[model samples]
Target chain A: MSGFLTLLKRDLLLALREGGALGTALGFYLIVVTLMPLGLGPDLNLLTRIAPGILWVALLLAALLSLPRLFEADHDDGSLDVLALGHMPLELVAASKALAHWISTGIPLALMAPILGILLNLEARAYPLVIATMLAGTPAISFLGAIGAALTLKTRRGGLLLALLVLPFYVPTLIFGITSISAALLSPAGFQASFLILTAISLVSLVLGPVAAAAALRQHMQ
Target chain B: MTTDAATQTWTQRLANPTRFMALSGQILPWLTIAAIAVVLYGLYLTFFVAPPDYQQGETVKIMFIHVPSAWLAMMGYLMIAISSFGLLVFRHPLADVSAKSAAPIGAAFTLLALITGSLWGKPMWGTYWVWDARLTSVLILFFLYLGLMALRSSLEDETLAAKQTAVLGLAGVVILPIIKFSVDWWNTLHQPASVVKIDGPAIHSSILVPLVVNAVGFSLLFFALHMKAMRNEVLRRRVKALRMAEVEQAARGRDTSSATAG
Candidate 1:
């Protein structure tokens, strides 16, 4: 248990020290949001209407950009091999790494999402719900993403293939996330249903992510 | 131990590439006959026997193609998922081959479904497409098939590709439900109530019978195609092995010649 926290802390520190992945994901997310209005035309009504979906999609892509950092650096440096032999189970190790990712990458992305919402000409009332939905939804991105990252850890077509494999799984989260926010904005009465669904997706991914990642890690190592 | 050995032998016998080839070769002709006959009869039923819909008139014929392909598309993925589980848990020797072989068949069926559905949509919805739940979900299913195939092809090492894709394939289980629900939830939130359904109240038994027959025919076709593809994969592996042996022999011969020259 302590080891889990220690591993999580170490990964968080490494992510902060490197600052490369974190910065790039944030930059990419910001750029995508900024570009939406230009591409779709400068229609404030249009922007506000589509803001939640655009934000959710961009959040997903940004989180995807950070996935390779979850395992590639460790695998490349050979610590993954050492970690494979550690006292803590590989499942726990995967869980710790993904937890660190959620805290470092996912949380920051979620925090920045509402700020980016303004650029999309989002409704003032939607600000809180956008942040909340993103915060709830982004963990699924990090956690479920760990499975794809681990599977592609040593493959040649690393980044693109990782996107292809992981994006479909992200669909439900994207659906529920966007729907929940839209529900909140349109009808807060219906918000709980989609929001609860969003929460369920995150919790399911939170548990299944490490288990699947550990399995992929264990199998490929053989 | 003897009983265990007996059960193991049955699995080994079935899974052995050489044996699979021979058995499937024998089964292939019969499967082809079954596919052709059933599909012929099903087509006859679809066009001749099945009554035209009161709503769709002629476009109702499209369901004969669309629904079966849609059914097969989903079933094909289910088959791959089962094979993935087999590879991961049971370590079935042929599971990887089964998963790989099913992709093209599955993708083709998915594409057929989409095209046919679009054709049907033109007359019924007065548009070529509708972003309804079922159609959207099937499109996602098509993408899933493509992803599996892409992941398989990208890696150079056969063994590594198999292991990686098996894990990748297993992870795909989560998407199936999303595909199932994308329509209902989409409808719930923003009902595309304008587009009429193919399987509406107007579907008489005459229309349904041919649809069922055509579905059975397509199943036979899927089975035949699957067996033929699986056989080819087994043979491809054999060709790979023989080539590797030839390369090793050439290397050894070069070594001996170099030694003599020295």
Candidate 2:
């Protein structure tokens, strides 16, 4: 457990020190969310209707953009091999990486979503749900991304392959994430089911992601 | 290390590339014949015997091909994963062949699903494509197949190619569960599962019999095609080995002749 925490802290610190790793994603999210209104014209009602999908997609792509770096740097520096042999389990290492990713990528993206929400002319009432759905959802993407990262760890083109492998797995989360927020805004009762399903999926992936990733990492290491 | 009795194991028997070459060579023709017969009969039953869906009409005929092909596509991924596990754990040569052969067959199945789906969709949904969960996930599966095929070709070393492709095949298996649960979890235009329900398949027997027959036919077709593919790979590898031997023999002759001339 301590080892896992240390791994998590180290990755978090690495991400923090690596300038623009987190910022680039947030910047992209901001640009996409802000630019939509410009392209679609200033219609708050229309924006409100499309805001949830736009926010979800922006976050999805942004999360994906940062995914390759998760394993590439460690693999290059041979830290990944060292970690593979460490006293800690590979799954723990994977979990810590995912945790670090969520903090570095998911959390920051969630925080910036609401600000972008305003640019999209989203109502004040929808802000919480948008933030809430993102907060619950983006971690799943990071977790799923970790598996792809592990699989393509030794591949020549890890980044592109990572997206190809992971994005399909992202669809369910993306759908639920967008739907939950839209449901929250449009109909209160419909929101809970989607949110609950989204949360359930995240929780399930949270448990399974590390194990599957570890299995994938083991294959690569061998 | 293997005694004659030990050769009874499927893994052991298939481990010998030459053995697989011979076995598949003998079986291929018969398998092909059976596959053709079943598929033709299945298609006949699907078109003529199976009653039209009240909701979908003749357009419903597409389900016989589309749904079964889709099922096989998913099943092919699972097969690839199992073969990959075999390669990783047992380091069996035939396991690599199994994974290699299954990919193109899976891709073909996925393509069939997509094409037939569009054909059905045109008349039923009034559109050739919808960005629904099922359709999108199927598309993604197609891409995964393409990725695996591309990855296999990108490597020069045969062993490395097998290992790398195996890793990818295992990872791609994760998409299966997500696709399965997509309909139930999300509010999608795609209808919920009617077959393989918690209770039982809701489908009526009139349509169900032909569906099952076609499903079996498709599975058999996949097996037949995969065997043929594996045989082709074995032949290709044999030719490569023979060519390498010839090159080495030529090099030895050149070395000997040059020494004599000197």
Top DockQ model = 1
On the 0 to 100 scale, the lDDT of residue B46 in model 1 is: 82
What's the true lDDT of residue B18 in model 2? 78
Compute the interface RMSD for each candidate structure: 1.5, 2.8
lDDT of 2 at A196: 91
lDDT of 2 by residue, B79-127 (tens): 8999998998888888998999999899999999999988888887889
lDDT of each: 0.86, 0.84
Q: Report the C-alpha lDDT of model 2 over A112-197, residue by residue, as the tens digit.
A: 88888777777788889888988998789888888877766767776777777777678779878887877777789889998998
DockQ of candidate 1 (2 decimals): 0.65
